[model samples]
Structures are given as structure tokens and as C-alpha cells.
Target: MDFWQWYVRRGRIDRRTWWLQYALPIGVLSVLALMADVALGNSSLESIATGETGYGPIVTLVGLLALPASVSSGATRLHDRGMSAWWLLIGLVPLFGQITLLVLTGFLRGDGGPNRYGPPPSAAPTAGPYLQPEPAPEPDRPPYWG
Candidate 1:
């Protein structure tokens, strides 16, 4: 599915997808557990590296926590726009670059209303933010009086 499609389906950015999508990265880190065997064999990278390095694990855990769904959805968005998922690094550009990238991704203009992705979102008339509110009705009078 396209980005907008994914976005609408998911409704909101979430953590479950992050874990699934980033399974590879987390698997790589799990290799760290092997350090114990290496240490026992006197062939470890660091014999005394203990007390939970803290940052690396914390960061990895957080990334894994958010990888599965979010990353997949983000990729869909890029594909919908004929852009590369790597372009998501635009988040690292600092200041306006990040904001611009966010705006583009957050809003799905769709592919000409119906591109290779699929049909527009049901083609229903969407309410715009600028729509004027309906005026309040006055106190009711008898129908016969009117």
C-alpha cells in the first residue's frame, strides 16, 4: 500500500511496527550476548566490559521498540511519492530541512488521485479547515406563526 493508505490504516504512528521492521538491526545487537562466551574463552573483544554500557542498549531498545510499524509506514510514504525510503534521513538535516521533510511525509497529496498505488481515499468530499460554521438557530417559534 502507499504511504497515505498506510497512514490512514494505522491512524497514528505507533511502536509495534518499529520492532518488526527493525528486527535485523536488533538481531545484530543480540550478538553482543556472545561476548560472554568469548570472555570465558579469553577471546572476547573486552574482558571487563560490564555494568551495562547503558546508552547503546538503551538506544537500540528504543529503536527496536519503534521500528516495525513506523519504519514500514514511513517507507510506504516515500514509495507513494516515487521517493526513496533513504530520503527519510531528511530528518537529520536540522532545522527547516527536518520540518519540510516532515510536512511532505505527513501530508499525502496522493498520486494524481489514482496512480499505481490505488484509488483516492474513497473520493469522498473532504471538509476543509476553513469551512464556516453553521449559524445557530434562533429560539423556536410555532410552525403556524412562521
Candidate 2:
């Protein structure tokens, strides 16, 4: 599916998609925004990175701009894990909320086949992020009754 179509948040996505397509872009953009914030004298990178101060305007704006994509993409990952999008709310909790959601949506494996959420996402990047996973070929073996 196209990035615009995936942005609607209606399907499942595997870890690779969640990482490469969603998380990676968001992270890279956020870093660029942080550099802009520093250049604008809004906040120092060391201070923000050390948690002495929160991110400044540019970073915040970039994060806000990316919020919908983040939420929807995260939901798709949750769907791939065979859970509903509501699970994204876990990020609302203090401290552990975001951490738990990160692990659940980013680290764990998704359902191995077609699930309630939909078929598994494509393993190949060129085929697009959302496609049926290729079926595994059977292994060579002796006959059961031989």
C-alpha cells in the first residue's frame, strides 16, 4: 500500500515495516528537528538529550506533524500482533506506558498467518509494506509410511 493509504491506519504491518517505514523516518526527522531547534537557540542538544529540558519548538512541531502517522502506524503494528488499535492507549501511562507499547509494537513477532487483523505484511520492501507474506515451501522428507 502507498504511504498515504497506510496512513489511514486500517491494516496490519510487520516489524520491518513498523521500523523502516514508520519509526525510522520519524526518528530521523525528529533528529533533524532537534538540530533546527538548537540552531534557533531554543534548546541545546546536550540539555535536551540529558533530559534537563524538553525538546524545543521545531522538534515539538515535527513530532506533532508526525503524530498521526506514528499513532496509525503503531496501531497497524498492534493489529499485526493480533490486537486492536486501542492498545495504543498504553502509551498514556507514566514511564512504563510508552516502554511497554514500544516493546509490544516494535519488538515482538506478529501472527504467522492470516489473522483477525489481516494477512501478514510483505517481507520485501519493494513489493510495498502491506502484502501477503510469501508462503514457506515444504521441506524434503521421507514418506510417513516408508
Candidate 3:
């Protein structure tokens, strides 16, 4: 899938691509945030490593900017699972809700075929013409000499 479709577009996304789309940006931003904290020299590596407030507003701004893409991609992933995108709002329920959403998107598989969202992300090729089974050979005579 294209870059835009993977992150911004409102379409179906299989579970595998969902993790990639979700983790890649978050991981990059986290690394950049840590680097920024080190560059400022206002905190220790331990603080940055633990995600403490060290880099100031840069990390916050980047996180805010990345939010829409994350939410949109997550919504599309929910669609692939034959669920409403609004289900993502369940994450608002605190720790349990977050874990629930994680399991739904990460562990569960999407619908096997086209759904209300669209065709499956990894659709199998259409079946070819059916081949008839070969006829079984006749049993050999038990005793031709008889």
C-alpha cells in the first residue's frame, strides 16, 4: 500500500501492517525525543530513557502532530476486523481499555474477505477452473489362474 494509504487514508489494514504503521512513527519520534533531551543537556540519560519530561515542548508538539495519523490508521485497522472505527474510543477507558484495544488490533485477525470497509489487504488470488478428479484404477483380479 502507498504511504498515504497506510497512515492517513480511511481504509482497511491487515494486522501485520497495522503494527508497522503504528510502531514505526512512535519509535522514530521516541528516539528523536531522547536525542533532543540529550542535546539540551538539561537531563540525564536515565530521565530521557524513562520518558520523563525533559525535551520540553518539542516532544509534546511532535506527539500531537502524530496523533491524527495514529488514530486514523488505528481506525482503519478496526475496520479490517469488521468492527466500527468508533470502537477505538474505548481506549478512553484507561488501562483496561488500552489493553483491550491492543489485543483487538494486534492479536485478532481481520475478516477473510471483503467487508464494509473494502477488500482485504492480503486477498488470495481467485480460484481457477475446477479440475475433475481422476478415475480410480480397477482392482486387480484376485486369482486370474482360477
Candidate with maximal TM-score: 2
What lDDT does candidate 2 reach at residue 53? 95
The residue-by-residue lDDT of candidate 3 on 1-146, one tens digit each, is: 67666458666887777777675767798679757856777556777568875555666677777787788877888999999989999999999999999888888999998999889978744455575554555588343442
- TM-scores, all candidates, are 0.36, 0.75, 0.69
1-146 in candidate 1: lDDT tens per residue? 45454334422222233334333445554565444445445344343365332334433454565455456666555555556668777777888777876565565443445445444334434567678565556668533443
The lDDT of each candidate is 0.50, 0.85, 0.77
Backbone clash pairs for candidate 1 read: 17-67, 17-68, 17-69, 18-66, 18-67, 18-68, 18-69, 19-68, 20-68, 21-68
In model 3, which residue pairs have backbone atoms overlapping below 3 Å?
none
Stretches of candidate 2 above 4 Å error?
A: 1-3, 46-54, 123-146
Structure candidate 2, residue pairs in collision:
none
Those runs of model 1 whose alpha carbons end farther than 4 Å from true positions after fitting are 1-60, 121-146
Over 4 Å off, model 3? 1-3, 41-55, 124-146
How does model 3 fare in lDDT?
Answer: 0.77
lDDT of model 3, residue 66: 76
User: What shift in Å separates residue 86 of candidate 1 from its native position after superposition?
Assistant: 3.6
Choose 2 or 3, whichever is better by lDDT.
2
> Model 2: which ten-residue window has the lowest total lDDT?
137-146
